[model samples]
Target: MDVKQVSVADKARRWIFSVHFCTPIIIIISPRLQILILAFLAASVSACKMNRCYNESELSEAVERKLRSHYHQPPDPLPAADPDSPSSCPVELYQYLAPHEENRRSLSPWRYVLRSMKDHFPSTYSEAECLCSGCILIQDVPGKGRVPVENFSYTSVPIIQSRVFLRRDLCGDGGKYRLTPVSQDVAVGCTCARPMST
Candidate 1:
C-alpha cells in the first residue's frame, strides 16, 4: 500500500494552478496576472480552511460555543393573555437542556445502540412543551350517560413546528458533516374552547 502526503502549500498551488490561467504555451505572464493568481490562491485556501468540518472534535467545540451563547442570553418572556379572554386550562412549559431529552429512555426491546453516537449540533431549539395533557373541565362529564352538560368546554393544546439542526454526512464531499434543519413538533400552549357537540 502506498500513501501520498500533501502539504498545505502544495495543495494551494495545485488549486491555484488548476485555474484557466495555466497553459502549456511558454508565454511570459504579466505581473498583474501573477498578482491575481496569488490573490486567488490565498482566497481559496482561506475559504477552504473556513469551511472545513472534519471531525467530531470540531462539532463538540461548535456545540459548546453555541451552548455558552444560549446560556449567557436571557430567553424571551411569554406573551400575556388578554384578561377578558382568560383560559381556565393553562399550559405549563419547560425547556430541555440537552437535545432529544424527551426520547433518551428506550422503551422498546429492539433498540440498536451506536457506539460512536455523540451530542446533537447546536440550534435555535428553545421551544417548550405542555406539562399537562388532560382536560380539566371535561372531567365532570359522565362517560356512560349522555348528560346535558351546559357550558362544557374542551381545552385543546396548540402544537407548533420548529426546526432543529441535525448532523448529516455528505458522501461525495469527503464525508464531511454538515448541519441541516429537521422539523420537530412542539406544544406551545393550551386553550379552552367549546366542543363542536355542545
Candidate 2:
C-alpha cells in the first residue's frame, strides 16, 4: 500500500476508536482544532445554563414592569368588598355601579337598586332601621326573593358601601348605618323610606 494511503488509514482507525471511546478523536489529533472545539463547547454550555436560570416569577415581574411603564398605574386589583363590613360582595359591584349614564340601560334591577341606595341613602344606619326601612325597598319580586339589608350581617345585606360614608346611629338601638343613596341613573329607585333622625 502507498505510504500516504497507510497514513490515511491509520487516521481513520484513530477516528473510529475515538468515536467508540466517546472522545473527539479528530480534534485531539490537532492542537489548534482542539482549542477551537473547547471554546465552542464552553460557550454552548454557558448559553444552556442561562436559558435554564429564568423562572416564572422573574418573567411575570418583567411583564408587570413593562405594563407599568406603558400605563402610568399598575393593573387594578381584583374587586373586593370592604374587609370590615358585613357583606362579602366583590368589588365588581361598585365598579358596575359607577356613574355611567350611557350604560344605565345595561344594569339589572338589583344593580339599579344597589346603585340607587348608594346614591340616595345616608352612609350608615342601625340594624333595625336597615331591616325595616333601609333595605325595605329591595322587595322579593316574582323571580327575586327578599333582598335583605339588615345589620352588617352577610345574610340580609347584599352589598356593603364604603365605611367612611357610614356612621353608627346613637339615638335608637345603636347600630351601623350608611347614608349614600343609590345612583340616580338607575330607573327603579330603592323602595325603602328615608330614615328619620331623632
Candidate 3:
C-alpha cells in the first residue's frame, strides 16, 4: 500500500472532523449504541495524543469538566427522582475506577457510568435509568493546551412499559393510601466517561 505523509495538524483535523461526522450516524442507529460510541470516541480521542493516559483522579476531574460543560451543572448530584428526598440515589461521580490509579492503557473517557438501579427506601425513593446506546468523541486542537480537551459519554437504556401504582398516604401510617396514579413509561438516562488529555 502506498503511504502519504500527513502533517500532525492535518491528521488531528481529520480525526476531529471524522468523529463529528460519524456521531450522527451512530446516534441514528440507536441510543444504546450511542453510549458505547461515546465511550469509544473519548477513549480513542484521548489515545490520539502521544501520552495516552491520565490517572483516575485526573480522569475523574475531566469527567466533571465534560459533564459540567454539557449539562451546564455539576456532574455530581445528577438528577434524581426526588430532588429533595435525602434517600435518593447517591450522587456518585464515577461508578467504576480504573484498576490502576494511572491510566495503563486507554482509559474509558466516558467514566461516569450510571447503571440502572432502583433506590428503595422506607420514607423516600428514587431511580436512575439508562435510556440510550452509542456515543460521541471530540479531540482537541492540534496544539492548544489552555482549554484542556474534554471527553465524555451518556448512555440511555431502553425503558420497558409497565403499570406502576403509586400509593399516597393522605391520612397517616396505616391510614387510607390512594393508589390511583399509574405509569406506563420509564425514562432512563445513564452516562459513563473518563477524562481528556491536554
Scored by lDDT, the top model is 1
lDDT comparison, 1 vs 2, better candidate = 1
Candidate 2, run of 10 with poorest lDDT: 127-136
Who wins the TM-score comparison?
1
TM-score: model 3 vs. ground truth: 0.22
What are the lDDT figures for the candidates, one per model?
Answer: 0.39, 0.31, 0.33
Per-model root-mean-square deviation over C-alphas: 16.2, 21.6, 27.7
TM-score of each: 0.33, 0.18, 0.22
Error of 1 at 117 (Å): 11
Model 2 gets an lDDT of 0.31
Tell me the TM-score of model 2. Answer: 0.18
lDDT, model 2, position 156: 23
* Model 3 agreement with the true structure over 1-198: per-residue lDDT tens digits: 222333454343212121245343211223466578899999888656412233434544543443344323212323343333333121222234345522111222211222332221011223333311322223455675333222325332333334242322233343332222234343332334332335
What lDDT tens digits, residue by residue, belong to model 2 across residues 84-167? 445322223433444643122122212221211232123222211021212312345566565422322122222333222211
lDDT-better candidate, 1 vs 3: 1
Encode model 1's per-residue lDDT on 2-41: one tens digit a residue. 2223345434422122223454332334447779989999
User: Residue 113 CA error for candidate 2 (Å)?
Assistant: 49
